[model samples]
Target chain A: MTLIAADFGKLGRSTLMSVASMLALAILAPVLVAALRADSIPAVKLNADQIAPRAIEELTGRNVTRDYAYAWRDLAAASESARADLLNDYFTGFAKDKLVRRIADQQKTGVRIRYIDHGHNVRALFYAPDGGEMQLVDNAQLEIEIRDGSKIIYREKVNQQYLVLMTPGADRWFVRSLDQLADHP
Target chain B: MAKMHSLVFVPALALSLVSSAQVPTLQVPARLIAGQAFTIPTHGQGEKTFYLLGPGSVVKRTVELGTEVKVTGAEIAAAGRYLALSCGSDGCSGTDFFVLPGDAVKISFLLHPSRVPVTAHNAINATAFVFDQFHNPVLRPVTVDFRVLPKNGPAFTKSVKTVQGVAWSEMSPAAKEGPVKVIATVGEQEEPRVIQQVASEACNLRIKARRTSKGVEVETDPVRDCHGNAVPDGTIVSVTAVDAQGRTTVDAPVKKGIARTQLPIHGSATISVASGVAIGNEIKL
Candidate 1:
């Protein structure tokens, strides 16, 4: 009985040692993997070409360009209701009303106006001293197609200039107003 | 049968005489401007009704024949074709007229390249469009005055007449760097805009290198233009080091008026600096 109890105690000690060693290995495995990863991962080298100037004008100009692209994309939808719903995400007040009215009138007249924004070149016109508002002038080229009763009536390429007003939001920016700087052809 | 025929014949004869005696005529101007009041002359005898229809509005009124009918600018504020019809007891007549845009009340002044390098030739373009209060482009000849005020120089002024409501002028930026105010004036209306005149590319850029603990430290002298104006901050300055091993280049931006970079050199390296098109001196250590 003594021999058997002594043998059992020895076995218990060995088993505890094995469990403790496994626990330690489990704890150190992640550290070892991380160190290996650190060795394999190369250091980040700064590329001169990748560095961009953080100018407010350039940043805001990009934002305005993107907003104009989105707005024009929304305006070219085939369905008036869908166009109105998408435009509400970008426009407000008189500009929204005018666009909605234009779409409604087109629907009533069985006419559709589609715009394809080729590109936009935006320049910062004015930024408020307090950074509350910014105005940008966008020179864009678009391919406009007018359809009547499933037939294209007219198609033309037009270069348009727009005066865009942007107001900063907490996380992003909002377009306050958009007006045509030049008369439409 | 004879009595009925006599009755019809007598009434038909009376109607023909009335129509012949009172012939309606309308006299109106060939063209009218939006937001202007005018009177229309007519000729007839008896009570007559007048109707005016235009692009966005319609007006109706009753007046005695031969009396002039007055139309207010508000009733004809829209620019398009207008029609006036007069219906008298005997006959009716209609006349048409065209409405032109009103006088200039606003101006949209656009200056291209809101930011330009100082002393650039013909780099700034100012374009102006005269607009009426109703946002219609006034397609009439008008003189636009462009005034450019530099931060620390004499103001430059130019006048250009508009063709088809557009006027534009190209001018060079000033020597000094700062905000340049551009103003466009048409009659009593004025529109002001600002263009940022930044320093031109670094000229005569030079640098120096010295031994540091890490390896070698390189720094540029105050980068200045040909006219001795300090180059603007955030302008890039490239530093390159070539050693026995290979070459390494660091494009550092000017901060606090100068650019500084630390290069790790093994031994006997040559270092050179440049800013834009201006190349600086080289040092071997």
Candidate 2:
């Protein structure tokens, strides 16, 4: 009986110690990994303007259709920044040409897209296919009429919503899917 | 005993603590279930585990924790001792949990059985038959995924598949009155997959009349229902008798189940039943 008790005590102590060690390791390992990897984590961000000119020119040389197809491909390849650039080019072109004629025109006449805002990693510029350096502006708008003062500009109304994506590398921002805003004009 | 209890409770307590932290953190919407297979959001995936518990301590089976799991069908056997889930062996054990969509939280019982019903509403006769996943007649309220296919017509390729799911009709009276073919798929693991098909005839207003040896008989017998049931008796019956050139004689108060008035020696009178009648038969009255 004494031998059995001694053996049980020894087994219990080992099991308790092993389980405690496992639990402590599980709890501490992630923290340790985070600390070691902290330097690699994002500290500064790159906006569209700050993006490498070579990367921008490589992206812009492709037409809008090619840009979108390449964007989808890049997204599949996990090159999210390239995808963002392609998307920016596509939307900028769309806003310059289609937004006024199709969307804003339906509400009122002679509507123009002003200056589009690109923040963080987003690059906003209007691309004219048959061009000689046309001025691409941010025609996107945001309204907080209920809390803030409301104002109407031009014959057409615009509403813009932007989203910020914080990934392991850095923080990048982009516009949501586009549709023109109208204010009972 | 306290130590033993702690051994059991500690894990559960820790799991609850972990889950509470996670509940508000996840922004993913509930999963949309497709036929048989469910796609989990690969949150940097290797294996994602979920638990499937039976009535009480009974654990039917554990499924693989992977990005994709397919459920061909399911059935209740042994009065619900085990849920026979259909799948290829992918490291499933009885002790493991069956991962289901988050909506499953709405349910209290694990082994809830649902049924798919097919009713022939406007069938002229009782030739209509309803078959379950096993091709058996089921006459109880059931919750299951269903698809509708028309006879000699293209079957709807897309089906509404739901888990944590009940046929809306099973829970509400309004769903029963509809004319729809419902197919139900269910099960847990192993040989428990089943597919049930239900056919319902739409409720339609139809008029039927037969000529008897007796003079110009006009009666509403076997009122056709669009949903495949014979029309009930005493539904306000009105009928019109018209001569060849559209000269008409409208009759009054022909009861729904039986509407009849003898017409004098007729040379093919066009008999038309009223639109308000559940069913109307056109015959020489």
- DockQ values of all predictions: 0.01, 0.01
In candidate 2 the C-alpha lDDT for residue A120 amounts to 16
Which CAPRI category fits model 2? incorrect
Query: Quick one: how many clashes does candidate 2 have?
Result: 49
Estimate the TM-score for candidate 2: 0.20
Off by over 4 Å in 1: A1-185, B1-31, B36-76, B82-95
Candidate 1's residue-wise lDDT over B1-285, tens digit each? Answer: 111111111111101111233444467886677788899986656787676654334555787877889998876765544556665554445655666677888787778678888877888878777767644456567899999888888888899876545567788887777889999999899999999987777887888888888988889999888777788788899999999989989999999789999998869988888887778888888
**Chain A TM per prediction:** 0.60, 0.19
Worst 10 residues of 1 chain A by lDDT: A37-46
Question: What is chain B's TM-score across the candidates, in the order shown?
Answer: 0.72, 0.24
Q: A89-175 in candidate 2: lDDT tens per residue?
A: 223322222222222222222212122112212222221121211111122231111000121121112233121111011222121
For model 2, state the Cα shift of residue B143 in Å.
Answer: 13
